[model samples]
Target: MTSSLPLLLLALCSLSAAEAQLTVFNLRASDLPSGIVVTTDGYVKVFCGSASLGETSVRNNDPNPWWEEKFTYFQGQENDVLRLEVHDSDIFFNDLLGVCQRQINFMREHDCFLESGGLLHYSYTLNGNNQ
Candidate 1:
């Protein structure tokens, strides 16, 4: 609506114009709960706010699975929170394994977050978040 233009402008004005990039290097899980008959097929998905960055391929049969996949997201803001979810892929329904979340601006150059059932390893170049 026309009434929202000024507010939008204000919000945009508050945002830093410099570029930023976040790189998720990999994710790994250990001791994932296995179904009675089968081992877990685990995967991971990442999000910046409500926007999905990408997901990893399922690694089958191993509770200690490492996905050395990389994902890059650009133009991050100060308030953006990075979220990662671990899941067990199943035939009927996927099970939620764990979740990790942290503010993008508060992260170090290289850090790991201990999720409920896993760990997310990531790094970011947050030159723009200084504003």
Candidate 2:
């Protein structure tokens, strides 16, 4: 009985640990239009426009090159923030003439701009109501 008591206590502890779980709520531009809002209990809500929705992969210059090393990995139950990307149409020109004339100048001045690879990254907190 004494030997079994320790095993039983260990099992109960593991079960309790499993109950305090962390979950992720991922949102993208494709999920909804500009007016829609998403909520998470312990995380910040992110909104990305349609132009930024598509397949997302690890960023080229990401410090972690592994497939699972992106922002999504950091999501947890408590104290999390969501990330979002939106399109800047004024800066991106569709025509070559516009690109040569205005877009180039904008790019040079800004030094960096968001690209439309068709993906939006977002994270949300998980709580009883939002989960």
- Tell me the lDDT of candidate 1: 0.73
- On the 0 to 100 scale, the lDDT of residue 46 in model 1 is 86
Q: What's each prediction's TM-score?
A: 0.71, 0.26
User: What lDDT score belongs to each candidate, Candidate 1 first?
Assistant: 0.73, 0.26
Native-to-model Cα distance after best TM-score fit, residue 105 in candidate 1, in Å? 3.3
In model 2, the Cα lDDT at residue 48 comes to: 23
lDDT minimum window of 10 residues, candidate 1: 109-118
Candidate 1 backbone collisions, by pair:
none
Per-candidate clashes, comma-separated: 0, 3
- What stretches of model 2 exceed 4 Å from their correct place? 19-26, 30-75, 78-131
| Candidate 1 RMSD to the real structure | 6.8
Q: Which one is best on TM-score?
A: 1
